[model samples]
Target: MLSLYRAGYSPWHRLAAGPKALLLIVIVLGVSLLPVSWPGPAVAAAIAVGCYAVPGIGLRELRRQLVAVRWAIGVTAAGQLVFLGPGPAAANTTRVGAALVISALLALTTPVGALLDALERGLKPLDHLGVDRQRVALLLIVTITMLPVLARLAHDVREAQRARGAPPGLRHFAMPFLVVALKHADALGDALTARGVR
Candidate 1:
């Protein structure tokens, strides 16, 4: 999604990153606050699809991107169904799904560098309050970049476990994955300290 956002040339791509970030936040909040109904979420979903359908973001690539998050989307949808009992459950689920789709579209259409730059500038006001805006911005960038890395590591670990005939279950996978992640975190910290990033 991050790659797709940075890959294409379009009106969305041309918009200033700060405005784009603000727009995303506003849309997400507006969607969240809307009464449980079909129209609002349906419209949001339509807009999300439209954003992806713009020139240069072919439907094929959109499908590919969505496929990558299929598991997460499925989990979220299932959780909503199970927890948001009866009545407005369907509407709630749909709204949650639409919000996910909208967020994915934003990431798919916005570069990571642009997001970081915008975040840095946007958070500048906090400097007056001694908020360490630069450090906060760096942390945001690191967190964003770590998502894909952690995902890839998890994928690799899953493949390795499968190769060893381990069944697919959190009980079988959780401990090892956590240990590996902790090791990676330690190594990352060491590297950052070496580079005087702290």
Candidate 2:
């Protein structure tokens, strides 16, 4: 479930994580701040296409990442349709989809450990403000690691219910997935405690 990173000797892989992450953040913020119907989506689309051209990544990975955010895109589009209009809705959806692709590209190229270490180092300067950089980094790492696991768990639960002749419904899977997630969280906490992380 945590197999987003693709190890390779490509230029993207050779780049340092700190600069890559900083650039991504800056770009995301810059695009997000633009007018909804401006050229933001067009520029983002171009960059996303460039991301897809990176070695070790293909259409399959791109499809998987886009599919993962389909629901969000649909909901956002629907909301904007009702409140704003079709043009703005389309532009906003495009922008959001482009952001998702860019983020997926980052995850696909960068190792999780490197990202976490970069985050910790980035946060070190804020130590005087009562922030625990290590703890924050750990939390971010855990959150990122759990995302795909949770998605897989939900998918498995749905499949299991379907195989058992139950209707394909989230209601049937919600409680079970919650229990499983809680158990996983407890195990994670115990493991961290044993490792003297706190």
Candidate 3:
């Protein structure tokens, strides 16, 4: 299976996945809630981008992450710029971009297995509510784990389009991307069923 877990001996890598995930969420949320026109999120975005300096993560990973979300950032900034003006555009774009970067950063520092374990642990108590906690955890963790995979697929699809000299458009991009995504989903479903994850 394709996994994003980078093997690292850094302290960041050693931190417990649950707490690290929580802290990242809190930071992103906190940044997002900053008042309109505030410069805080811009600063947060810069720091979040620089956080690629985490021991095992380097400029290459940072570049890949930024590239992965460039379209999202661009569209967000453009919309905000058009409607809300430059201040909100800067604030919102930074908030959103930093949130994604932090998410990718967590994937870089923690193993997908660890995230699954943490989710399982956190969701166990919900078993009494008649929820299939195992499947819930698996679903949540798998979605989180697929971020990098989706990013890679998008990159590959773009490269394939370029190689074929197909002009880039949302329809052309979405067609192939959705088809490839569904194929991956089918394979993942088969694997999970084989492993009794269903």
Q: What's the TM-score of every candidate structure?
A: 0.71, 0.81, 0.86
* lDDT head-to-head 1 vs 2, winner: 2
Clash counts per candidate, in order, are 1, 0, 0
Could you list the CA RMSD of all candidates, in the order they appear? 3.8, 2.8, 2.3
lDDT of 1: 0.68
Error of 2 at 193 (Å): 1.9
lDDT of each: 0.68, 0.75, 0.81
Return the clash pairs for model 1, or none: 5-108
Question: What stretches of model 1 exceed 4 Å from their correct place?
Answer: 1-6, 58-84, 143-156, 159-166, 183-191
In order of lDDT, best first, we have 3, 2, 1
lDDT tens per residue, model 1, 124-192: 899899897766876876675565456556676888999999999989888888887888889878866
Q: Give the alpha carbon lDDT tens digit for every residue of 9-116 in model 3.
A: 766688899998888888778767766565677677666766777667776877878888898899999999999999878888888888788777677788878887
Task: State the weakest 10-residue window (summed lDDT) of model 2.
Answer: 144-153
Q: For candidate 3, which ten residues in a row score worst on lDDT?
A: 34-43
- By lDDT, the best candidate is 3
lDDT for 18 (candidate 1): 83
